[model samples]
Target: MPKWPDDDVILFDGVCIFCSRWVRFIAKRDTAKRFRFTPIQSDYGARLARTFGIDPNDPDTNAVVHRGEAFLQSDAALTVLSHLPGWSWTRALLAVPKPLRNAVYGLIARNRYRIFGKYDACFVPDADLRARVIE
Candidate 1:
C-alpha cells in the first residue's frame, strides 16, 4: 500500500512512443499543473500497476491515480482529459460505454509497439519536464 500522490498521477509505458507522446500532450494542455507522471518502468509505477492487477512487464493499459482512486485503460484516459483545461469535453466519450471504450483502448495498447514503434530505452524527460515526473 504505497501512498498515492496528492495530485493526479498518470502511469504510462515509458518505452512506447505513443504513450510518451500522450504524456507530452497532457503536459502541454495541463497549465494548471494538476497532473503528475510516472513511467511503468519505474519502481513506484510498477508497484502501482501491480496493485491494480496490471502486469508491469507487459502492460496493456495506462492508469491514472486521481484523488486516491485508480482508473485503467479508457477510463484512465478520460479521467486525465477531464482534468485538463478545455479538454473536459473529451469526457463525452465516456457515454460511448465502458466495454466499447476499453475494447478500443485494448486494441491500441496491443498494437502500440507495432504501430507507433518503441524506444530503445525509457524516455528521459528533460529538466523542465522532469519536474512533473514522480520517481
Candidate 2:
C-alpha cells in the first residue's frame, strides 16, 4: 500500500453516489488539503478495511482515519467535519448520542442506492485533485 501523505484519510464506498457526493463536498471545502481519499474497492482501501475489521468487499460503512485513529459511520462524518473550517459546528450533533446518530446513519447507508443511486464504476477524481486520491 502507498503511504498516505495526509494524516487524515477518508475511506468511502466509491460505487455509492451518496458517498461519492459526500467526498466531493468535503474536498471542495478542504482548503488546507488536510484529507486524503480512498475508495473502499481500491486495493489500499481493502487493506485498510481488513485492518480495521470491516468487510472490504461489501462495506456498509465509511471511515475517517485521523491522528492514527479510525472513526466510522456517523462518527466518521462528524470527525471529518470537525476538522474543516466553519464545519466543526456539525460535530456538536455528537451530543445527540451515538446510538441515535448511528441509527440515522445506518438508515441512510442501507438505502443509499435506492435514494441517491450507485455507479457502475468507482469514482475518479479530476486532474487537479487526482493526487489527493489513493485508488
Candidate 3:
C-alpha cells in the first residue's frame, strides 16, 4: 500500500468559486498547516477520486484524506474544521445528524455552480501558498 503524506488533503471542485473560497478559508484557519490542497481536476486528485470509486469526470463530493482514510461530503467538511485551531466548535454540528447535514450539503452542491458561478479553469494558489498545493 502507498504511504500517503501525514498532512490531510482536501480534494475539491477546482472550477467552483465557493469551493475555492472554502479552500482559502481552511488555509487561513489551519495555523498548524495540517492540510494540503489538490484540485479534483489534477492528475493526483483524479487518481485519488478514482481510487475511492468516485467519478472523476463529474466529481461532486469534496473529500478529505487523513492518515490514509477518506471522509466525504459533510463528514469531510466537519473533520477538516475540527482540526483547525479554535474551530473545534464546528464539530458541535456533528450532533445535527448525518442525513440532515448531508441533505443540506447536497442542495448547495447541486446548485453551487448556478449560485456561486465557476472559473474558466482550475484555480492556481498564490505563490506563497504554492507549497501547500499538490498538482
Error of 2 at 35 (Å): 0.4
Q: Rate the local accuracy (lDDT) of all candidates.
A: 0.90, 0.87, 0.88
Q: How many backbone clashes does candidate 2 have?
A: 0
Positional deviation of residue 131's Cα in model 2 after best superposition, in angstroms: 1.2
Winning candidate number (TM-score) = 1
Worst 10 residues of 2 by lDDT: 1-10
Per-residue error at 38 for model 2, in Å?
Answer: 0.4
List where candidate 1 sits over 4 angstroms from the true fold.
Answer: 1-6
lDDT of 3 by residue, 1-135 (tens): 343454499899999999999999999888888899988899988888887767878877998998888888899999999989998899899999999999999999889999999999998889856799887
Model 1: how far residue 110 lies from native, Å = 0.2
What lDDT score goes with residue 118 in model 3? Answer: 96
Q: Encode model 1's per-residue lDDT on 12-36: one tens digit a residue.
A: 9999999999999999899988888
Root-mean-square deviation per candidate? 1.8, 2.9, 2.0
Runs with alpha carbons beyond 4 Å of true place in candidate 3: 1-7
By lDDT, the candidates rank as 1, 3, 2
